[model samples]
Target: MSSEVVRFEASEEFARRMDAEDSLRSFREEFLFPVHDGEPAIYFVGNSLGLQPRKAKTYVLEALEDWEKLGVEGHFRGTRPWMPYHEMLTEQTARLVGAHPIEVVVMNTLSVNLHLMMVSFYQPTRERPKILMEAGAFPSDQYAVASQVRFHGYDPDKDILRLAPREGEETLRTEDILDTIERHGREIALVLLGNVNYLTGQAFDMAAITRAAHKQGCRVGFDLAHGAGNLQLSLHDDGPDFAVWCSYKYLNGGPGTLGGVFVHERHAHNKALPRFAGWWGHDKQTRFQMGPDFEPIPGAEGWLLSNPPIFQLAALRASLELFDRATMPALRRKSDRLTAYLEFLLDRLPPGVVRITTPRDPKQRGAQLSLRFSKDPRRLLEKLNSAGVHCDFRSPDIIRAAPAPLYNSFHDVYRFVGVLERHARD
Candidate 1:
């Protein structure tokens, strides 16, 4: 499953042959690609918002019909039983992230989940009252950590440590990160980071980072908004204290769908951990008793605040079913190849036009390849849009493209490169 450049060629015939050989080719038809100029789009932005699954409508409609027919009884009498609807997704979601059902739950959106996890995990003491995180984390993560520290009466400037890449470097080194953890060992109360950097598409070593943080007697958590479905995660084995992610990107759930959270099983029964409690988190047996005492359901379910939206869960379940069938291992095999093919073709473009910011090693990244150009990519992005190459432009000069293994093909990558090459030439 190595992405050896020697086996690649820069030709349409080569792309077509690769597509013909790809075992995942049929999955492409399972999604609905956007149309541009009366043709299917060359969609490569799955890292941002994945293409909608053709089955999403079917799933949504089922829930709608259930609601209409059963009314409030849908809670207990519907086909899937709305009262336990979130349970249907637990095992599958856990499998996707390599965790047990007891450790995973689908609940609030990504940021809210982050806040909930921190409430339990980020217990800053007077002796060790600092948070260490990568510099330039997504703004939402930055805001969450900043506000959390402020709520505890600590100044973010003094209490938050931002780890940046070395001078003249674009990505952080594992050694630098470890060294930072060691240097700030005593002061650090928590270590937080995005498992995969959204802008650069650089996937961090979560296991290594978690081990280092634990060695320093610090709690560690990760924002997996980009890494969840794109990377092969072993949350339980990796030993991160907690993790959070949204379902829209590589998970292919509809826009603004439910997010997920992971809590290490070790903390499952720690009733002393602080959390914002709600009725849904109460014990299932006593939840309807109108009891005065709040007894949380053990494990990740304890953090849930409200009954999940059935329709959103339905959409996500539709996408997760696809992942269950394709399986991460098989998807990773094609993802490596599709991304390698994309890299191969991008390399053939004229020099000094665009530079890859993502790590070159396949093991160090997922399906995305971020291109930094010499000038603003806005005009070129517009041209790509008109040409039916669906991708996105970040501020200033970077363009991000992800060849999602579930539905994207080598031909899509090839056509995308052809359009980008023409734009670069002009």
Candidate 2:
């Protein structure tokens, strides 16, 4: 159902009716939700860890069986050869992020990829040594950027420029971001941001930020941990120099699974660009020759460090297959409606009971809604969890509930709000 056309109602029957009319509703059966009191709990924390795809077991066991049957030859002779296992994911991953196959690669975890990207893209000249990033970014990103600055013998406190929301504001304004880039473009070596802020659920305008940064001659990148599977991204068109994301969250690749990286096609063949390379990144033909010299692959694959864990690749392949079948455009359409429905229901609660910190504009947010309670937010979170609602709490009184469109229903949103409403009355 188109969000613009449907009139939302605050009733269970209405929620069920919307779910019944949903086109992607059947996709929910593909995942296994957690059980509480012998029924599927309201799993609304896909922003942290996605539910397991049923096919993940099949894919994982297939890889294990291949290893048992083929021994070391499994690398060369399996249903999906272990040696080239990562290749199976390339096309679907590229499609997920709206990048060309050459620009995307599945490799290390999010922080590792971020560090690797910085190694090549965060080159700090004597004049342009500062890194501009959003304040309160995911701690790992902040740490990585700081360490990189220190490695270059620059003081992080002086070289790192942190942009914060205006006083009394929960999210940063696009104009402010662009203006900051414009003002510090010369001193800034890179602009790194989490496209969707984890705590506030604010989705930045990536394309606009990219254009502004490029105009000022600064390298730009994003940490898309929350944006990846939740948002309809156009990394190639958006033209960020690089971007990285974890597969464990919205991507449903299991806990701590492999992450993905996108190095724009413009940077793909730049072999002269300094990078920490490994044998897996060498030309496949020459890799087995045990050559002393490293000849990196021509695209994103060149950044790969070592052979990937085959089991993780298999599990992620299962999820990526579903992503290919469902398509981001379809998922995004449902996501808009699901999130809107959730917002609509939450708004009906008595004012001052809870405040939503996420942007009300759908374009400025994703599926997750960050709720700030007027009092005892942690108590509310505990109450909600014990009541079989699965969500997460951040420090300083915020509970994040993400109704993932792929596996969540309007009924889930309705029930979640019912829980909140009942608890708020207490």
Candidate 3:
């Protein structure tokens, strides 16, 4: 926390003043904002899908041109050679997650990488076959873990243990999570959790959880779908056995783009570890030989299944360049202030109208704030959308809004709250 005080007020003028003072404000011009009523809408849904960078089109077009100019030779002689295209993203991706270049790789989608990581890290013996995880995890994670357990000849109902929040609570307590790990230490083989809860916007202490799980002799991993570009994480220092994340969210890669993975350097050269083999995962020097013997590439690249997707990687590179110029430490500083300002404004709304489900503590969350409304939130969100507030709504009662540090402005948050307040009065 800086000594400089942030006194939030419920006025548009105050919002403009903050925006003027924000050093990162100019970066907002780089994105393509959604238009509503012939003006840029207040977009607060970066947690679901990020706004496209204006440079993405140019990058993709460059790749398209290279492919057209050079046919088969493009693999080795393109503007950015297709053969080693993913290598261009490795350093930036690693820096974003606080990992070494050898430990990070951009490959398959989130679910596919989760399954691939499980193949190597989730070995279960007769005595310790259970997998532990947070209850109410994203549906994709829940399904992936359950299906993996079933594939390994274990019943998901008996082998998968889900830790839930206490009755009447909206989020899990760190103490509770540790205590559960202690109590179930013997039967657990692996502990997998989403670093930031998608629905509640609660960020977990990954290092602490990893320490606790490792103490209990359990292998741990994270689904960083919401944490990757939103929070400052030290994946290598956190010491999880492996972690996976989608690039489409805060990473601002285009929709359904490729995902990222991190494997601890301790396992980087371990050839004995079991993994599903692929041509791309073969040793790069000998890969063209096409030998029948499976020679795994050391580190996270060993998990890749196919050649890189050039267009998607090109778009991702554009976003990464913006992030490089902005830098993580600065973005995180602005993110903390932006989310805090959102909480401040929401607290001033009429009593009992809406409740914030995400934690108030900066350490426990990222840029997103999930609101649980008193009435049917679906209708409320629809009304907000009609007013040009482009946030996301979950089933039943929650609305998730995120003021992305890279593009969103303080004025945007102010306008979103104003729409919600007017909708409540209506």
> Candidate 1 lDDT, tens digit per residue, 257-370?
999999999999989999999999999998989999999999999999999999999999988988988888888888888888888888888888889999999888999999
Ranking by TM-score: 2, 3, 1
TM-score of 2: 0.99
- What does candidate 3's lDDT look like per residue over 1-426, in tens digits? 353868888899999988898888888999999899999999898899988999999999989999899977888996788899999999998999999999999998999999999999999999999999988899999999999999999999999999899999989999999999999978899999999999999999999999999999999999999999999989999999999999888989999999999999999999999999899999999999889998889999998889988999999999998888888888999999999999999999999988999999999999999998887788888898888888888865788999999999888888988888989766
User: Model 2: how far is 410 from its true place, Å?
Assistant: 0.3
Q: Please tell me which predicted candidate would have the highest TM-score against the true structure.
A: 2
Q: Candidate 2, overall lDDT?
A: 0.94
**Under the 3 Å rule for N, CA and C atoms, how many clashes does model 3 have?**
0
In model 3, residue pairs whose N, Cα or C atoms come closer than 3 Å (at least 3 residues apart or on different chains), thus clashing, are none
User: By descending lDDT, how would the candidates be arranged?
Assistant: 2, 3, 1
**Highest lDDT among the candidates is held by which one?**
2
Whole-model lDDT values for every prediction: 0.89, 0.94, 0.92
Over the stretch 181-294, how does candidate 2's per-residue lDDT look in tens digits? 999999999999999999999999999999999999999999999999999999999999999999999999999999999999999889889999899999998899999999
Each prediction's RMSD over C-alphas, in Å, is 1.4, 0.9, 1.2
Q: Candidate 1 regions off by >4 Å?
A: 1-6
lDDT of 2 at 355: 87
Query: TM-scores of all models?
Result: 0.98, 0.99, 0.98
